[model samples]
Target: MEIGSSESQSECNLSIKLGMEFDSDEHAYDYYNEYASAIGFSIRKEYANKNNAQGM
Candidate 1:
């Protein structure tokens, strides 16, 4: 996904998908952090791992 300031919603949707299931958590966070930085926002670590599957 191409993340940019003008593409906040698309970026957010991609972040949601990444949170659900992407290549890896580290990668997801990297992308999310980059996006957040570009858009002047900050995300907590707790929120980053909220979508982790717990034996489901």
Candidate 2:
């Protein structure tokens, strides 16, 4: 999920919280294959967009 905080200098934070069930082999494989890059890109894009907006 994307979070914004005024106290955070970077303006945005990305966090991945994994539960024990998600640590299972089946879930881990799916997470690495399907969700990892999308999550990474979402955080990166959101931060970049916010930065650009702030600059303008």
Best by TM-score: 1
Clashing pairs in 2: none
Model 1, stretches more than 4 Å misplaced?
Answer: 1-21, 47-56
- Candidate 2's residue-wise lDDT over 1-56, tens digit each? 25223234243333345553565766655555444444433212222343565674
Best by lDDT: 1
Off by over 4 Å in 2: 1-15, 40-56
The superposed Cα distance between candidate 1 and the true structure at residue 5, in angstroms, equals 8.5
Error of 1 at 13 (Å): 15
TM per candidate comes to: 0.43, 0.26
lDDT of 1 by residue, 1-56 (tens): 44443655554544434326659888877877876765657776763335456732
